[model samples]
Target: MSPPKTYLITGTTSGMGLALVKHLLSQSQNVIATGRDIVSRFPREIVAAHEENLRLLELDITADVDTLQEIAREAWGLFPGGVDVLFNNAGMSAVKACEEASEEYIQQIYTVNLFGPMRLTTAFLPLLRQKTTTTTASSTVIAFTSSSAAWTPLPFMAHYASSKAALSAYLESLAKEVNPPPFRISVVGFECGGCVTNLGQPRQHKQQQQPQSGGSGGLLAKQQEEKTVYGDGLGKLVGMFTRDAMAYMPGDADKMARAMVGVIERVGKQGGGKVPVRLVLGSDAWESVKQKVEETQQVLEEWKEVSWGTDREGVRGGAEGDYLRAVSIL
Candidate 1:
């Protein structure tokens, strides 16, 4: 059997984060679960049973960069060695039309979903690298719970989709800079499907409730909106996420968490094999991404002439050539 791995996961108060903590513990892996109030908030049963393997830390991903670095230092001291995996799983979603999304709302979404994770990743890299450099037999991985919304747009989710898309793109760029030997940091993003978690809860819940469940973060929706052109359409959108309605969604949080764990373990075993750039979970996520890819291909084929016409004729040159050559692509 593969040996237990140390995982430091963020946003562990509930939803995908909590489920992942439960799943990893069941596998006898060492887990450093973090959230806003993880010590008192983590389930007592699991904590008591796995006291030797589990450690709880209070981490608010949206904190300032310096605070995040301090927390990373504290987390580094919890376990005996380097963290085997760092799951940047904390995220929040906003549900509003482009016109109705307040600047504050938009900023909150970006802070929690994109900027926060980026800062945390920066804070934790030194520790992850330390582990990799010292243990030639081990590999360190960083994973994100990115969403299928990144590729498949959904109504009332512009901010959410855009933020996730930006995060995924950033990870692609980061992988290129960090995946070298001596510090073999593997970066992956999972484009997960919708699941029955607090993530779909309306804005009221976000303001009124405490974090305690398995969800990316509670869904965001204003309780009241001034009359607007969207009218009935907006009403229908809000109605679709009522607690009863969300319960009917096909994806299961536990199942999604289990799938994520399985994929991470499988790839970790591959050693130097090419790490997956993005992985989609759930049947719905699969279909949505597949359709998006097909549509993108069609658009590219039809726009091929316009695309090529914009570029200068003959071989690439100037700064572009210099960049390509510097990167060894030419």
Candidate 2:
């Protein structure tokens, strides 16, 4: 049998990151997992148990650029041979309204969700390139954990959504720039639906209270409040979100790990083909993507006649179109 492919994943201490790590390890695949609080969050015995396939690295992706670069260098040194996949799964979400959200909160969210992943991907590209060079048949992939919020606007989460939007845009440009011969870059925008993850916890806001798990009735009440205030028809969305946040999603970490592994395997067999630029992970995300696309299409269609002119000169160049051009210029 061939050797197992190696993966390097960030934010492995909790939520999707932790789930991905557990899943990868169970497959007997090699994984280098990084997180801000690995030592504190994971039990020593549990970590030690996967010694053969797991390497825990402490990295706060939201750290200063220089510090993050240093961490990347250290990680590169640790995996001297290079990694097959660099999964940028570490991120944070802000629950406060944009106006109420502090600058610090906004900056922190952007740093973790956008800048950190971009820097890490830049640092690791050389190694991934090297792997592709040596093993002519293999390919390297860079995956990002984006959100459905990137597609649809969410009240009280504008900062989080904007940061993800920036990341998505950057990855789209980066994919175009990195196109070359046998070496290829695949960016998976994992637009996750509400999973049972720690994302719902309002960590960035100062006044928000911690979530409590009480009796079934209390949980039901909380769900009701979330729906009434947040939006209606959110039952399924909330269920998935609760499951992800609570670590109760079907098969929990295993399911996520297997899904990721399957994606990588499929990418590999396609002759180093790229993973879809977008991977809407759950049903909620699919609906959101569909709705957003349809809305955009509708808006464009409604204004098509006004947007399109009979001729280029008629639209902007001639004196007859100077007013239109001037308005357009603004």
Candidate 3:
């Protein structure tokens, strides 16, 4: 067993976030769980039983940066020893065709999925950095629940996937900026596969109090019916999901949470050494990424000449050339 570490997780009202909170508490780790209406969202009995190890705060990640900074400051105060892990796990999605997706809705998704996490991480950086200089200093990690949907092609998930892709890219750039020897912070993105979570439900379905899984079918159908042009294609897509919605996202949330903890523990145990930039959580996610990589490699191979031809004829030994050569891009 590793030493008990403090974890601050966003979006703990339900699904993977809630499961992570419970699993960490079970392991005797301190958890600061945040979400909107957490008192109603989390089981009261569990909260009472783990009062010493758990703290709940109401947070809507879409809030302004100043508000997020305030909450981050408050969270830092809750655990003065400093956080060992900051889990940016809160996310939301809407199920609608790109053509029909409103600008407001699109902006909302970006705010929640991309901008919110970025701002929150900025807010907590000082706190995370504080842990490194303390007498009881230890490795600190910034973890994200980036989705495999970032690279996979799933209809009506374009905006969600785009947001996650941006998040992943941002995290990659952040890892480069931090994680050097003295900084002692590690950034990891989990390209999580589908699990039986409420994420698939469109916002409207949640408003109507429908089942989380398979709830998007009716909404998707209604949208397509009005368009008519997308009728046949949407019908097949809806039919597939209606027949086996679970097939698309079959991983158990509890199990996924456990695996995530295991990974975090391993990274922490490394004593702030190098860790993977991203980890694929489930078999479905692994396969999706694998396929995407292979196809990309094939494309690159086919376009190798054209890609390399774009460079200037006289360009050879400059800084950019040297760096590209070092990485074998030349």
Candidate with the greatest lDDT versus the true structure: 1
Q: Write the per-residue lDDT of candidate 1 for residues 124-231, one digit (tens) a residue.
A: 988788777777745578889888889986787789899989998888778767777777788888888767666644333333323322233355334344566666
The candidate, 2 or 3, that scores higher on TM-score is: 3
- Total colliding residue pairs, candidate 2: 8
Which pairs clash in model 2? 194-240, 194-241, 195-244, 196-243, 196-244, 196-245, 197-244, 197-245
- When 1 and 3 are scored with lDDT, the better candidate is 1
Between which residue pairs do clashes occur in model 1? Answer: 14-213, 14-214, 14-215, 15-213, 15-214, 15-215
lDDT (Cα, tens digit) per residue for candidate 2, span 172-245: 66765553565665556666655555554433442332211100111212343322444433465456445544
Q: Give, for candidate 1, the lowest lDDT window spanning 10 residues.
A: 205-214
Residues forming the 10-long window of minimal summed lDDT in candidate 3: 208-217
How many residue-pair clashes does candidate 3 contain? 0
Global CA lDDT computed for model 3: 0.75
Candidate 3 lDDT over 202-225, as tens digits, reads 443323321121112233333343
Deviating ranges (above 4 Å) for candidate 1: 201-229, 236-248, 270-274, 313-330
Q: Against the hidden reference, what TM-scores do the models get?
A: 0.86, 0.77, 0.88
